[model samples]
Target: MGQVERAALETITPYKVEVVQGNFVSKDQIDQLRAGMSRQQVREILGTPLLTDVFHAQRWDYVFTIERQPLAPQRRRMTVFFDDDRFTRLEGDAMPSEQEFVAGLSKPRRNPRQVPLQASEEQLLAAQRDPTEAPPSTRTAPDPAPTRYPPLEP
Candidate 1:
């Protein structure tokens, strides 16, 4: 009964696709941010904010979330504050370095197989024997030229 219940649960389980959304600001990008920089400069550095509320005209929110199976969902948020259209400060979760961030996003191969870089002796000999000749099934005969043609002017 336990085995049957386990099989039933596995059959009914739905596959969940990875969901990654919002701006992904790296440590390098965040480091480039300056206190006196303008909104445009901040945008260029971190990309457009994910959320900008009308009530908080001077604040811009950058939110990032990753939902992947077999692992817990990850979320990061950064809020940039401004005064009179000039950048002031930012607050958020500790961001990963560019390299660290890339490493985290990459998944290891289940079974890595090495491919032979050099051709086998048999393959080399076959290629050298008839390099220009293609297989009979792939070869198509050219159409014969017409013996006569209608007058172009008529």
Candidate 2:
């Protein structure tokens, strides 16, 4: 045996698979999958799923997850949505649904309105002070209107 082959065999760990690599299901394979195929056929071809939604009986999902640990976020998720036991939609960083993709980007979340939490008179006075008077970091604009707490009736 060659030096490289000998080293590979020696360093081979239980977690690592040697010889024939695992097959990766491609878009072509998923496209070729036909509708009305029995559950047995689907299972035989694709193997078991990472997740299965029990809420929807008609839809079946196949998910592939890849975790990349880095300083920045690395998201690699593949979800294939099947309708009537046939592939209808696929979502992932690689392939995104045209219909749902546009809808997702259309709306952006609005900033929540800041409400004055319950505060004593001293706290309220401090907040109303001029921003320039306070330290550079401590400078904060005063609320447009102070919260009015109703006085107790005799």
Candidate 3:
């Protein structure tokens, strides 16, 4: 291909896909998991872990990672250690609380800019009226009464 054609193709080519990988766990649940808790209790609070190996049956790992374009990536891991079937301790990165997590996802609200030629009251009323109230159709109406009945001679 010529230089001009090559340049055009390169410019038009689509951007690469964002890579997002790993398990996600909330900080609230992690905080609830304390030392001396049974394996079952920890599981109930944190759900099944992402990694569980036969060699490390006593240790459960919860790993979460996310990556996207034009935004900083996030990664977190929570490890729960067990000694003789009871939780010993947890070690991982600090995480946001449930409220903070939710707040982060919300979009900022801004006052809408005023524009000329706003819709008149009449137009708004007309739009609000139900569209189902259209002109009557020529099609015949369905029978509201039922004709089927149980056998008289049982």
| Candidate whose TM-score is highest | 1
Model 1 per-residue lDDT tens digits across residues 1-154: 6998977775564878989999798889999988899999999999999999999999999999987765667899999999999999999899998798767776555346699889999888787766688864788898999999999996
lDDT of 2 at 65: 33
RMSD (Å) of each candidate, 1 decimal: 8.5, 21.8, 10.9
Clashing residue pairs for model 1: none
| Preferred candidate (TM-score higher): 1 or 3 | 1
Q: Which is better, 2 or 3, measured by lDDT? A: 3
Question: Which of the two candidates, 2 or 3, achieves a greater TM-score against the reference?
Answer: 3
Candidate 3 residue-wise lDDT, 30-84, digit = tens: 8797789999999899888889879988899888776654356677888889999
Give the Å error, residue 99, model 1: 1.3
Q: What TM-score should be assigned to candidate 1?
A: 0.61
State the lDDT at 105 in candidate 1: 72
The C-alpha stretches of model 3 lying farther than 4 A from their native spots are: 1-21, 106-154
**Tens digit per residue, CA lDDT, model 2, 1-154:** 9999987785553653222222334454555556566655666766665566788664545544332221122233455566666655555545344454334334233444589779999777778877559564676777688578678995
Q: lDDT ranking from best to worst?
A: 1, 3, 2
Could you tell me the C-alpha RMSD of candidate 3 in Å? 10.9
In model 1, the number of clashes is: 0
What residue runs in model 1 are displaced by over 4 Å at the alpha carbon?
Answer: 1-14, 108-154
